[model samples]
Target: MAWSYRKRIKLIPGVHLNLSKSGISTSIGVRGASITVGKSGTFLNTSLPVLGLHNRQRLSGPEPPSDPTSSPSDRILPLNQSRGNIFSSDVQEITSQNMQGVKEVLLLAHQQRKELNSDLLKTKASLGGSKVKLVISYLLIYGLIKRSIPEQIKSDIESQKEAIAQLQQAVEDSYVAFEIDFDQELKERYQKLVDSFIQLTGCAKIWDVTGAHHQDRKTTRSSASRLVEKREVRFSLKSLPEVKLGFDALCFQNANGADLYIYPSFVIMYSSKTNFAVIGLDELSLSQSYVRFVERDAIPRDTKIIDKTWAKVNKNGSPDKRFKGNHQIPVVRYGELILNTTTGLNEQYQLSNYEFTEAFGNAFRDYQAAIRGTKQR
Candidate 1:
C-alpha cells in the first residue's frame, strides 16, 4: 500500500502553510517569487511561467536578507520543523505518534551522543585545516585577537541579527497581525500567576508511566489491594534562572524537556529536541496535587519533610531489619502540577513548594476565565 499527503493552505496574503509527507513549512511571497522555510531548511522559489524561467535555491550557506517592516514570529515553525537540533521531523499535530518519534530521537541521541560528538569533531578537524587560516585572519580583523570587543560579544551580536531576520521572515510568511488589550484585573491576575511561578523551586517532569497495576477485593474479604503506579520522571541537571513574566509574554523552562512560553492568546511549547507547538490558552488546563516522595538523593531545601520512611520497608511499613543496609529516609512532600489539553498536550511537573504551584495554577485558571469573559464582551 502507498500513501501520500500534500496540502497548501493560505494563511494570509502571500503566506501559505504547506503540508507534505516530509513536514510542515511556510512559504512567504507571491507567485513570481517566494521563500519557504521548514524542517528541511530555507528555500528560495522563483518562477516566470510566461518566460519559462524557474529557480530554486536552498539558503543554507549564508544568512538571508531581512525585511524591515516584518515582525518576529518565534513560534511560527511548528513541531518537527526546527533546524536547531535533531528533532527535525514533520509534526503534523500534537499526537502520540508525532511525539513518540521525537522521544525515540532524543533517547537514541542520548545513548550515542558521546560517540557522535567524537566522530563529528574528528571529521571537522580533518576538513577544517583549509578554513583555519581564514578563521584566524577574520578573528584578527575583528579585534578578537587583540582582546578588545571580544569575539563572543561580536558573534552574539551577529547571531541576534540573524535570529531576528529568520523569525521576522517566518512571521511575514505565515502569520497575520492582530492586537488585544488586557484590563487591569486581567493584568493583576496574570502578574500573580507569574509571581507564583517564579517562587517555585526544584521541578521535575514525569515523562512516562512505566507500569500500573490494579487490584480489587470484595467486602467479604479481609485483605484488599489497591492500584499501584510507577512513573518515569526526568529532572533538570541545573537550576533554572530567574525569569520575569510580563503581561505580553512569559517563558517557563520545564524541568525536563520543553520550554513553555505563555502568551495572552496561546502557549508555545518548545522542546530541546527542536520540536515546537502552539496551543490555545482556552484549550489548556491545569491540575495540582501533593506527593509524599521517598528521598534517596539530596533533598531540596524548599520541599517539606512531612514524614519518614525506611529505605527497606516491610509489608507493615516498618524497617526490614533483615537488610543490613536499611536506613531511614525522609518522606518529602512535593507539589505536583499537571497541564493537559485535548490535543495531546500532557505534562507533569513536581516542585518542592506545593503552595506556589497551586497558586500559579489557580491564578492561571482565573486569568484564563477573565480573558474568556472579555472576549465574549
Candidate 2:
C-alpha cells in the first residue's frame, strides 16, 4: 500500500500506464504520462500523437460540420498578403531596372545618332567646299584659255621684225610722197583730182568735192584788185618789193559749206629771189595736237584733210611755205586715191574733219600728188 510502482495516464483519447520503482514518482495527464525514480528522478512526459486522437470529454457539444465542397488544401493556410506584396515589390524593382537599362540604351543610341548626323553634315560640307573649289578652278582655267590663246597667237604673228619694218618703211614712204607745198595752184589741182577720182571710181555718190563756201566777195574782190594793181605797179617799178607770204595766206573750204580762212599749215616767209619753196607739214594740225610728226621712223600717214589739200594743188607750183590748220590729211597711195574713196564709202559718209585729216596727210601738195599719181596710173 506504500505506493506501488504503477501509474495510470490518459493521452488524448487513449489510456496508458507508467511505472517506477525504488523511490520512484510518476504523474499522469490527459495528454501524456510522466515518471521519476531515485536520485535521477526527472519526470518526462510525452505528447500524444495529434493524428487519429479524439477525446469525447474534450469535444465541444455538436461541432459544426465542414463543407464537403471546400478543399482541404484551400483551407490549409490563409492568403499570405505580405508575401504577395513582397513579390510584387520585387517584380516592380526588376521591371524598373529593365526600364532604366532600356532608357539608358535609348539615350546612348540617340546620342550616337546625333553624332552620326553631325559627322554626316560635316562630311557633306567638306565635299561641297571641295566641289566649289573645283568648279572655280575649272572656270578660271577656261577663262584663261579663252583669253590668252588668241592673244598669244596674234602676238606671234605680229612679231615678224622684218615684215613689220617693211610695213613701217612703206607707210613712211607713202606719207612722204603725200607731203606737198601749200599753194593755190595745188589747191585747184587737188580739187580736180578729187573730182576725177570720184568719177574714176564711180564714187560720185560717195565723194564730196564741192567747196563749202567762198571767201567774202568784198575780200576776194579786194584781193584780186590789189594783186592786179600790184602786178601793174611792179611792172612800172625799177625793182619789185619782196613779198613775204604769211601763214594766214591760205583758205580752207569744206563740202559742208564750212569755210576756214586761216594761216597756212605753216608759215612761208619767202622772198621773190628764192625760187625754192620751203614746205612744212604743220604737226600742230594733227587730231592730237601733241602727236609726233614721225611714227616708227616714218612720217605718219596723211589724214583726209591732207589728202584733200594735196588733191587741190597737185599740178601747181610749190608754195613757199605750208601750214596745217585744223584739218588732217589721210594716207593715200598714189594710184589708190579713187579706190580708197570707193572702198571707204562708209567712212566718207561718216567722215568728220578730224577723222578725214587723220586718215590722210596734210591737205596741200601731198593730196594733189596722190591724185596725180592716180591719174597717171
Candidate 3:
C-alpha cells in the first residue's frame, strides 16, 4: 500500500506553513485562494469552502511537452531520450532512501563537515540568546540596567555571523575527493571503453527478454492465439532501460525517478543517461553478447556489418518474391552488456562497439577480483 503525509498550520493571519512528504512551503492569502512556494516549485491553490471543491495548479516552471516518440512500442525506432523523470534543470533531486549510503561514499571530508556543523550550531545559539536578552533589556530599561544591551548584542551577532561565513568557506575548501583509480593497463582499457561510449552516435536499444515458449496455432477462430508475449520485468517500478549511471559516485534512480548516490566500493553500472549504480564487485554479475540488429536506418560507426536481409523476408532468411520493391537492410552486430545483482539491479545496454565493450566487461571483472584480493589481505 502507498501512503503520504500533508499538513497545514496557520502561523498568523493569512499565513500558513504547508508541510508534505515532498518538502515544506508557505502559503500567503485567504482560504479561497493563495500562492505557495515549496522545494518542488511555486503553485496557486484555490478552493470553494461551501461547495467542497478545490483546485491546485503549478504557477512556475512549466514542464516541457512530452516527446511522443519516447514511448515504448513494437516499432523498430530505438528510444532516443533519457528514460527518467523530465526535469528542466540538469541537477537531480536526491531521494530519501539510500541517502546515508550517498553521504558515506561521497563527502570524503567528514572531519571538516563535523567541525563546521558544530561551530555553526554554537554560533546560532549564542545569536539567539543575544536577541532574547536585547528584547528583555529594552522592556526593563527604566528600572536598573545602565549599559546598552541592544548595541552589545548587535555587535556580538555581527561578529558571530562573520565567523559563520568564514567557517562555511573553509568547509567547502578543506574536503578531498575519494576518486576511483585504475592501474596502467586497466586505465588504458577503461579509456578505450569511454571512447566507445562517446562514439555511440546512434540510438541504443535496451531489451528485456524473458523465457520464450513455442506456440502452435490455427487460422480458425476457435484456435489458440498465434502471437506469443514475453513479460518485461519492472525493477523498483521502472523499466530496465530507465536505470541511470554516473562516474563520480555510485548512483541509482529511485522509484520516484530521483537519484541516490552511494560510494563506489564495487562495480559501477553506468547508463548513457548519466545515471549509475554501485554494487559490490563480488556480488555484481555481468554478461556480454552480440546482437544481430536489423538496421532500418543508418548504421552506427562503432557497430560491424554482419550480413544483409530483406525488409520483407519469408520464413527463412531469403527475401519474399511476392512483395514488390523489397529492399535489403544491413544486419549489424551490436554488443549487449547486461549487469545484474541479487538485489534486483538489472540494467542492459546495447553498445555500438562489440569488441571494446566485451574487453572492458571481462577486464573490469578481473580488476574487481584483484582489488578484492588485496583488501582481504
Candidate 4:
C-alpha cells in the first residue's frame, strides 16, 4: 500500500508521522524517497544515497495544467524547480520556512511516543520480561559451519574486534564500510548463507532487508591481504544485520515486520535491557517459528508429533521434489552447517506450516564459539 497517502498524520512538508495502529515512525520524505525513523533506526522507501541526492522521480499526481490567466505570484513551483536539492539554497529556504513547524510536530510526536513506550513496556512485561529471540532464523543455514579456530584466527579476532564493530556501525548508515582481515573461506561461506536468506524471505531486494533510510548497500572487502584477522564476513553488514526492537520500538504495527524478518543476533535481552553477547552461528542453527509453532499447536506446544513431515517448494512457490527431507539430509553437526533459514522457513510457514525447534541451540553455540576461538556467552 502507498503508506504516505494512507497515513494522514502529515507534519511539515515532506514529513509525516504515523501515530496510528500501524506503528510508531516518522516518515520523512516526499514521493521518490522516504525514511521511516523508528526506534530500530531507520528504513528506506527508496534506495537513495545517504544524503538523498538522486534523479529518480517520486510518485506524484498529474501536474496541473499551466494557465496564462494565473498571476506569477499565484503559480505553484514546477516539480523540478521546487528546490535546489538536499543541500542547495532552495532546500535551505524551504527548511528555514518550515523549521518551526517541523520542530513542533516532532515535539508532539515525541510526547506521544513516550506515553506509548510506557504502555508497550507494561504489555510485554506482562507476557515475559525477557525473550529468547529466534535470532538466526532469518539467516541461511549453509553459513553456520565452524572448525577449530586457528591460533592466528583467535589473535586476529581479539585485535580487530573493535574495528569490526566500528565497520558495522558505518555500513548501516549507508554504503560506507571498512576493510578487516578475515578468512576467505569464511567469507565465501557467509555469502551463501545470506543469499539463501534473501531467496527464501520473498523480500524484493537487499535494501528491503537492511538498507538505512533507503540508502544503497553492498558487501565489500579490501584487496589488501588474506589469512588475516579482519575480512568481509567480519565487517559486512550481514554479520550484524540486526536491530533490537524493544517495547519502545514496537509501538507501531510497521515495526513488527522486522521482528518477523531481518538478519538478527541471538542476543538475550534481560529485564535490565542488557543484551547478552550475541552468539553468531557459522553452521546450522536452531530456530522456533512463532507462526508455525502457533498454527501447529493452538494451545502452545500442543503439536503431538515429535518429528513431523512437511511439503516443500522452490523459490517460485511451486512444489518441487528437489527439496530433501531431514532423514535424507546428512547431519553434518559442527563440521558443516545446514544453512537454510529461507528453505526451512518456507517449509514451516509457507508450505508445511509448522515449526522445527532448534533443539540444538546450546550444542551449536559451543561448537560455533570453539571454532571461532571464543567462549560461548
Query: How well does each candidate superpose onto the true structure, as a TM-score?
Result: 0.45, 0.14, 0.43, 0.19
Please give the lDDT score at residue 256 for candidate 1: 35
What's each prediction's clash count? 0, 56, 7, 23
- Stretches of model 3 off by over 4 angstroms after superposition: 1-150, 166-264, 267-278, 372-377
lDDT of 1 by residue, 1-377 (tens): 11111111222222223222222233323344344433234555564221112222221111111112222111121122223111212322553322232233223333333333443354344335424543665667854455434444444334334433443444333322223344566657767866665555334433222222223333212121322133444432232111112233556545334666665545656664335565555556655556556666777666678888776666566776777977788877766555655565555555666676667666666666555443211
- Report the Cα lDDT for candidate 2: 0.24
Provide the global lDDT of candidate 1 against the true structure.
0.44
Q: State the lDDT at 150 in candidate 3.
A: 65
Q: Choose the strongest candidate by TM-score.
A: 1
- Given candidate 1, what's the lDDT at residue 44? 58
Compute the lDDT for candidate 4. 0.24
In order, the Cα lDDT scores of the candidates are 0.44, 0.24, 0.41, 0.24
What does candidate 2's lDDT look like per residue over 1-20, in tens digits? 01111111111122111111
Between candidates 1 and 4, the TM-score winner = 1
Q: Judged by lDDT relative to the true structure, which candidate is superior, 2 or 3?
A: 3
Worst 10 residues of 3 by lDDT: 1-10
**Over the stretch 1-377, how does candidate 4's per-residue lDDT look in tens digits?**
10110111211123432221111223333334434433223345554432221121121112221122333223222212222111111211221111233333333333433444454344344223112111232143322343222333333333333333332333333211111222444334334444443333231111111111111111111111111111111112222212322211101001101112222112111111111111112212332221111112222222232322223323343334554551221111110111122112110111121211222223333333433444345
Sort the candidates on TM-score, descending order: 1, 3, 4, 2
Off by over 4 Å in 1: 1-91, 95-178, 201-248, 254-257, 271-275, 374-377
